[model samples]
Target: MTLLPKNPSRLIREDDRDSAVERLREAYAEGHLTHEELDGRLGRALTARTRRELGAALASLPEERAGTTSTIATAAGRIRRRGAWRVPRSLKVASAFGRVYLDLSRAVIEYPVVDIELRLGTGRAKITVPRDAIVDVEDLRTGWKDTLYKTRRRSRPGGPKIRISGIMGFGRLKIRHARR
Candidate 1:
């Protein structure tokens, strides 16, 4: 008799798991989820081995329901956020062989600080922000091609700050200021 392999769960990366946890925290902070729910989902997220399991863990969260605004680009498609769109405090992007563009020049930003969690696989992400807003990409992890940020001046007072953090593989992340 031949031995067959069991149905193994689709393994998830540590960074992906961490991102899910962060989303949970944001949900809790926004008063969308209680402490008990956060704890339970966090626990489930930490132990989740498959993407489906992780997705299930966060399926019922308010942020994922209708609370936050986010964009995702996959396969060979392109995702863009421009004009007067609402900017959520927490933004998550997952791109594989796709392009993600975020133009925040005239966006309606509700939070003073925005956190962007990105996962890039052989893809690219370009972000355009207001000239006065601050941009931070220290938390980003790129491969051979390092992420780039082009700005005119340093962060000013009362300006919105964008925090970009996450993992990248064979991709590029560029941050530019919108043209006047």
Candidate 2:
């Protein structure tokens, strides 16, 4: 999906409101809209009494795309890598689906270590990393709130390194650094 600008001047025009609504409907039908997400965006799109306000809401819609996948491993083979590592976006249907495969695999013996790197075009990112690893988070864009949560930790030599970049809208990035 193409990333829309965080602030698009075209969204405020009276003529574009209808098209924006249509796009929202399309996105909803595609199963990309969660109840909360639909309600939030719809509320903004509808409650905006002025064209400018409506435009602002429409312009803030999230967009994202998955890039490449790579594997990283150490010679000792004590550590295993998994999960999609990348920025988060509004549209995560694909990522959610991909998780099933990740869960089922016992360890493709051929590649015991795999670190998937997902390239995000735009949107929020939520990440999870192992506890034994060190985490480094960098917010490339300003004015957005990004959070990290440590869920669990194991006695290991190192931790995971997570990074977030290219945030173009108003949203939050919540990460679980370890397992509780």
Output the number of the TM-score-best candidate.
Answer: 1
Model 2 scores worst on lDDT over the 10 consecutive residues at 96-105
Please list the residue runs of candidate 2 whose C-alpha ends up more than 4 Å from where it truly belongs after superposition: 1-124, 146-155
lDDT of 2 by residue, 43-115 (tens): 7876664666676656645563343343332222122234322322221222211111121111111122223
Q: Which digits, one per residue and each the tens of the lDDT, describe model 1 over residues 73-99?
A: 577788888876667888988877788
Residues forming the 10-long window of minimal summed lDDT in candidate 1: 2-11
Whose lDDT is greatest here? 1
Q: How does residue 105 of candidate 1 score in lDDT?
A: 84
